[model samples]
Target: MTDVSVERRGHIAVVTVHRPPANYFDFALIHDLADAFEGLDAGDCRAAVLAAEGKHFCAGADFGGGGAPGERVDSSRLLYREAVRLFRVGVPVVAAVHGAAVGGGLGLACAADFRVTVAGARFHANFAALGFHQGFGLSATLPRLVGAQRAAELLYTARKLTGEQAVALGLADRLADGADPLPAAMAFADEIAASAPLTVRSMKQTLRAGLADEVAAATERELSEQARLWATEDCAIGIAANLAREVPVFVGR
Candidate 1:
């Protein structure tokens, strides 16, 4: 089964990460998600909810998926850009993030206009721990909420953050107290649907212009950083070790 799925419900578009057990995948799911994002019709819809179908939202990358180190993955960029386009469709987006929002999964959540998270939800980068580069325009989106220093701290430390910390960091706008956040997100979408379309579109445009600039900057940053990592021994060593099921020891090369 594909890890990610998209379905339309009434005027609500729901995107779910359905990969079970750990809820993880790499290029496969990321590409599917990008395609799903493209096919969504938020203009006719009231709003969209990004939720998951397992015990956790997403456990991050699928190291076991077996893709080359640099296989030209524009999925992350495409996903974020499509999100920008969707927000421009005169409809709001409210993400219902339950469980783990790690790495690129956090990137997906960050693209949403607002996020409603369950009480026990958790978030983290966890990339630094694995010695990899960041993706999904997080270079731009994350700091907008958590400040540059805080974002740097999170990335550098690869610390796991609880849903409470996520709310405190402004990453999550609302907490759902063990309740399913999908209903609340749909309600928010309904509020947006009932509002004047032009006004909504205009505000969305005005807001995203700032984010657009950030996205551009982030694209450059992500590219440069990833490109640099592509050549480093660290990336090769880490990836190789994972493939071999052995511990990678980096000499800071």
Candidate 2:
């Protein structure tokens, strides 16, 4: 069964990620997302609202899941490869973030053109706390949204920002008036769909020029760094701490 679904509402494609509770992503899910976005590029989808059906929008990768060390590294590589394809798509996307978007999940939200979120939602770059480098092209996308210093602060601290705070920092585009972000996101997508298609595409192309290539390069470095860190004593400790809901004391081995 596919965890991703695409629904058409006129020119707006509502692409939803379906993984309940924490909504942790894997290679298959990211690959499915890229496929959905690329498929939209070929059709009449002028705009898309990226939504999720679960408690959390995405809680990043499931570190607690079973996988051999080498298999885990390979999966990360494949996931990042598919993630880069999301940046190459031309369709404008507005993410409806109703809950937590953590680690690479935050990177996924940043990949969109705009994010419509609620104040209750949390945006976290938790890779550092996980004892790994940030992946999923966040090194490129996060800096582009909130500047180098702010991105560094977020990545370094692994801080969680509420949606209002994210909007204040220019990380999120809009804070929804209602509790849920889907309606607001759809409205935002409608605004994009209302524009002249060719001109909109031209503007997007100009504004996001070279972004895909930049993300691709950044992900390459991020993957390499993460691979090295995954074998560290700190990584194991951090993951165990996270699963246990405790703060980790990294020895920096």
Candidate 3:
């Protein structure tokens, strides 16, 4: 079964990440998402909703699996390449983040033009907590969404933000008061789809001018830092502690 699937909801294409449970992504899943987004360009899709089928939007990547740090870095670079394609897509996207969007998952949601989340949803930039440098172009995207100082605070503290907090900080666009955020996001997309498609596309491109280039450059720097940090003793400790559900005691090795 494909991890990513696209369905039509009027003029809005719903691109869903179908990986079960936490929907932790890897290089393959990222490529699938890119493909789904690209495929929509040929259809009647005037807008899109990016959502997931799982308990969380995405819990992040699984680094605890057996792999050399070098291998992990290599895989992450490939994933980021596909992730950049998500930013280049033509249509405006609204993300429905119903559960936790942690680490790179948070970055994925930020890639969308808008996000609709629930009050109980969570957003976190956990790279620092993992002793890992941020990826998924968050170094650029986060600062763009929430400003430099707020992004710095989030990255440095690695704190979790509630959905309401995300909206208050302008990290998320809307908070769904109802149970499911997908319908809210689709409704928002429908509103966008009601507009002239060409105008919407042009406006979206204009608003996001040079953003793809910025994200590409940021990913390069992020990957370079992550390549170095992935091999650190502290990173390993953090990963172990996360899997064990314990507070990580970083010795700053």
Candidate 4:
């Protein structure tokens, strides 16, 4: 069974990440999403809305879940490789971020061409707080969406931004007035689907030219730094503190 489901709404595809509670990601989830997007490339799917079926959109990777039940290094590499495929999809995607999109989840949202979020929705780049380098190509995507200075602030401070703040910062494209954001996101995708499919696809390709390559390069660099940081005592402390819901004390290690 796949963790993702793709349903066609006219020319728009609604891709739901169907994990409960936090909807954390791993290698399998990434592969599932890649496959879903690849499948959407066929048929009449001209645009897509990426949404999650949980309380929080996604809470990042489940660090306490033991990580995909495989060799950690190999799994991480495979996860990133599949994640890069998300950027290569031909159809433009509008992400519906209803709850929290944090860490890698925020990167997933950033991968979309546009984001539709509810008022109280949260966006965070918590890599530094985790004592790890940002992954999922966030190094490229975050700055691309919100500019260098804002991206640097979000990463360095690891502060959470509400939907309105995210829109103000250019991190999110639209803020829905209601509680549910998926309908608004799907509406946006439907508007895109109303256009000429080929023209839309071509324009998207032009607008996002070289983005996948940039993300690929950024992910490689991120992984390299993360590998080194994963061995540090501070990283362990950060993880422990997060799990305990407390503040971490980093000794610059």
TM-score of each: 0.79, 0.98, 0.98, 0.96
Tens-digit lDDT string for candidate 3 (56-115): 999878776759988888888888898899999998999999889999899899999999
What's the C-alpha lDDT at position 122 in model 3?
Answer: 93
lDDT tens digits by residue: candidate 1, 173-197? 8777665777877777777777776
Question: In candidate 2, which residue ranges exceed 4 Å CA deviation?
Answer: none
Weakest ten-residue segment in model 4 by summed lDDT: 65-74
Q: What residue pairs clash in candidate 4, if any at all? A: none
| Tens digits of lDDT, candidate 4, 133-197 | 88899999998988999889999999999999999999999999888998889889888988999
Query: Distance (Å) between predicted and true CA of 88, model 1?
Result: 5.9
Model 1, CA-based lDDT: 0.71
Model 3's TM-score against the true structure: 0.98
Which ranges in model 3 have alpha carbons more than 4 Å from their true place? none
lDDT string for model 2 (128-182, tens) is: 8889889889999998899999999999999999999999999999999867899
lDDT of each: 0.71, 0.91, 0.91, 0.89
The deviation in Å at residue 110 for candidate 1 is: 0.5
Distance from true location, Cα of 90 in model 3, Å: 0.6
What C-alpha root-mean-square deviation, in Å, does candidate 4 show against the real structure? Answer: 1.7
Clashes of 2: 0
Number of backbone collisions per candidate, in order? Answer: 0, 0, 0, 0
**Candidate 4 structure, TM-score to reference:** 0.96
TM-score of 2: 0.98
* Model 1: residue 52 alpha-carbon error in angstroms: 1.7
